[model samples]
Target: MSRYFLIRIGQSLLAIWGIVTIVFVVTRMLGDPAVLLLPLGTPDSQIQELRSSLGLERPMIVQYLDFLRHAAVGDFGLSYQSFRPAMEVVLERMPATAILTASSLALGAVLGAATGFAAALARGRFLEFVVMCLALAGQATPVFWLGILLVLFFAVELGWFPTGGWDGPASLVLPTMALGIFVAANITRLFRSSMIETLSEDYIRTARAKGLMPRTIFMVHAARNALIPVVTMLALLAAELLGGSAVTETVFSWPGVGRLLVQAIDSKDFPVIQAGVFLIATIFVGVNFLVDLLYTLLDPRIRLGR
Candidate 1:
């Protein structure tokens, strides 16, 4: 188990390094942010001065090394726009993002699991058909459109929730529903399929033949086996939710990292952009690591094989 954990950690570190390198290269390729930061028709000398001040005058390799060095200590340089530490700016908005992410994830997971479990249990019945139809509609709907419609109905027409901005719990409902519905739909499909396959396995039949209660055979035997793939899907879904939050946040005007990232991109704020991407990438890698650890716990064979 220790060896497995070490290998996963090593892989995660390598992946983060690659993400940082990619973000650095790509942000630089978007043109000099110093130019964007300056006024129209700024003199070349003034631009050069600003560039030098921001360390753009340094060689690419030197800047990259500096970025890596500082990032190792949780520094991501100063934002081109705010002049504050880049990570500081990112962290300031993290709470909102974290709340939105957690709420959406929990809502989606519960809804998906319950719906999927019901569908699996009632396999060919009307309930299964209704659940599948709802899942299909959710998957087909675009998040942005859904968010807008939700705002229109709940906020504008009914006035049950705020249209945009983060103020209180009421502000969260629409965005959470918009983000979670898609996740729930995908998870429902995956879980339903996995459950069906698991139910057909010989071990499930053996449990049933052994005269175990139907609930035990279904929950303990079948559900446990079915969850392995769902666990992996959930990890990937977390990363997707973080990335997808940008669109939802934009639509809802939520004061989260996603909205911050969009604002930075629009203003060509390279430092903030790099920091945001790096942070999201780090979260993705971290979630995958946890999922790997969960795999061993869920099925001891995974640890034994390693």
Candidate 2:
């Protein structure tokens, strides 16, 4: 078990390093932000001075090595725009992103589980067909488009909720729905499939033959077994939700780290961009690691194998 945990931790750290390295390289390739910081007709000498001050004049390899060294200690440098510590800016927005991620996950999981169970129980019926169709449509739809439609209908046409902002819980409704719809659709399909398989197993048949009620057979026997795979899916879904929030946050103008990253990209703010990507990658990787540990509790085979 100790070895298993060590391996998982090593793998997660490697994944974070790879992702952060990629983002660091990509952000640098987006052009020198120092040039953008100056006036349109600023002297070339002044621009060069600015670049030198910002340390962009250094060789790419040297810059990358320096970044990695500082990053190892959680120092991601300063935000070129806000002049604040880059990670500090990112962390300041973490609460909003965390709220959005948690709310969306909870909403999606509950809806998906309920609809999936219903679809499985009502297989070959109208409810099953309708649920499946909706799930497929939800899966196929792009999150940005969904967010726009939500804004159009709810915030524009009917005015039930605010279009964007972090004013209150009311402001969260649209973005949460936009980000969570795909999660719900995915879980619905997976849970429905698992439930169907569980229902077909001998234990379920025996329970039915022994005069077990429908609810009892499903809640006690089928749902519990069906949830094992879904637990894994939930972890993956959480990572997806966090990644997908970039588009959702941009579209809705939410002041989360995702939106901050978008702004950083537009301005080519290397520190903020790198910090944002690194922080998010670390979080999702850590979430997956924790979920893997949770799986051992759910299934003894995992610990035994370890």
Candidate 3:
């Protein structure tokens, strides 16, 4: 188990390195930072001075090394637009993104898992058909479009929720629902399929032959087996939730790391962009690692390598 954990940790480090190198190289290879940084009408000599001040005049290798050193110390530099440290801005906004991700995952998992289990047990019943239809519609629908429609219905027409902002708990409702519903839909499909498979296994039949109660069989035997795939999918989805937060946050004008990232991109703020990218990548790697560890805990065979 310890060895497996170390393996995951090593993989996470490699992922972080790959992300850092790619972002660093790609951003630097783009058009001159000075051209974007300086005033449009600034004299060429002044632009050169500005570049020198920002250490942009140095060779690419030296610049990358400096960035690495500063990044190691949490000095991700300052956003050109906000004139604040990139880390500071990201830190301030992170809670909103965290809240959004947590809410989406919690709601999606519970709802999806329950719906899936119920549908799978129903098999060929009307409820199963209806659940499948909803799943298809959800999978086909894009999140942004859903968000817009929800805002139009709930906020614009009914005025049950505010259209945008992270001003209060009430303002979080629409965006959370918009993001979570699609996630729930997908999870439902996964859970239903996994559960159906588990139910058909001979072990389930054995339990039934042993006179196990239906509820006991479901809660103890089938549910644990069904949850494995769900956990895997949930981990992968966490990365998406964090990365996709940008679109949801933008649509709702929520003060989150995603929105901050968009603002950085629009202004070509390298520091903020880099910080957000690194943070998002780290989250992906971190969650994936945690998932691997959890799998072993959930299934003894995993730890024992059965």
Candidate 4:
């Protein structure tokens, strides 16, 4: 077990390195941000001066090395627009993003689990059909468009929820729902499939034949085993959610890293963009590691290679 864990840790570190390299290259290849420092018709000499001042004159490899060095010391350079440290700007907005992500994932888990259980339990019935319909609709809708429509109906027309900004919890309702509903739908479908398989297993059959109640059959014999895949899905969703907030956060004007990312793109703030991607990638890697740890707890057979 120790050997397996150590090998997995090395693999994870390699994965992180690969991701960082890809992100770095992609960000630089997008276009030179030095355009921001140039005037409408600036002389070539002045452009060169500004580029050298910002260190854009260096070879790409040298620039990357400098970035790594400063990043190791927690610098992350400066924002193109405000000139504040990129890390500081991202850190300032981290709370709102964290809140939104957690609430949305929690909302997804509840809706997903309930709907999944209901769909599986009510298979071949009206409840199953309705659940399927909801899942279909959830899969079909684009979250940003849903967010806009929701804001229009609830905030503009009906005066129910606020249109944008994170003034209070009241402001979070519509945006969180918009971001989470689809995730819940996907989770529900995955959960339903896993549950159905688990319910048909030999252990479940034995429990049912022994006259155990439905609750006991599910909870005691099947539910925990069925949940392993769902846990992996939820972890992946959490990772994607961090990166995906760009669309939702922009639509709702939430003060989060997602919104910052959009602003950074507009200003060609490469440092912030790189940092944001790395931050999200780190979260994803961390979640997967935890999920691996959870494997042994969920099933001893997993630890024993059964």
TM per prediction = 0.95, 0.94, 0.94, 0.94
Evaluated with TM-score, which candidate comes out highest?
1
Pairing residues by index, what is the TM-score of model 3? 0.94
lDDT of 4 at 117: 86
Q: Model 2 reaches what TM-score against the true structure?
A: 0.94
**Relative to the true structure, how large is the alpha-carbon lDDT of every model?**
0.88, 0.88, 0.85, 0.84
Tell me the tens digit of each residue's lDDT in model 2 across 141-256: 99999999999999999999998887789999999898788889988999999999999999889999999999999998889878888888888777655653788888888888
Question: How do the residues 1-306 of candidate 1 rate in per-residue lDDT, one tens digit apiece?
Answer: 677667778888999899889889988888888888899999999999999999999999999999899889878888888889998999899888888888998999999999999999999999999999999999999999999999999999999999999778999999999988988998898899999999999888888888999999888888887899989988998876665388899999999898898898888787898888888988899888778778877776686325
Model 3 pairs in collision: none
Residue-level lDDT for 221 in candidate 2: 85
Clashes counted in candidate 4 amount to 0
Across residues 1-306, which tens digit of lDDT does each residue of candidate 4 receive? 678778878888777767877877888877777777566888878878877878889999998888777765667788777888887888788888888888899998999999998898988899988998898899899998999999999999999888999778899999889978977998888888888999989888888888999998877667788889999998898887766488999999998888898888877888788777777777789889989889789877787223
Off by over 4 Å in 2: 206-212, 304-306
Q: On residues 1-306, what C-alpha lDDT tens digit does candidate 3 reach at each position?
A: 576667778888888878987888877765677788777898999989878877779998998998888877778887767779988878888888888988998889988998999899999999999998998898899888999999999999999999999668989898889878988998999999999999999999999999999999998999898889999999888786776488888999998888888887777778888888888888899888778778877776676323
Off by over 4 Å in 4: 304-306
Clash number by candidate, in order: 0, 0, 0, 0
In the predicted model 4, the residue pairs found to clash are: none
Candidate 2 lDDT score at position 212: 93
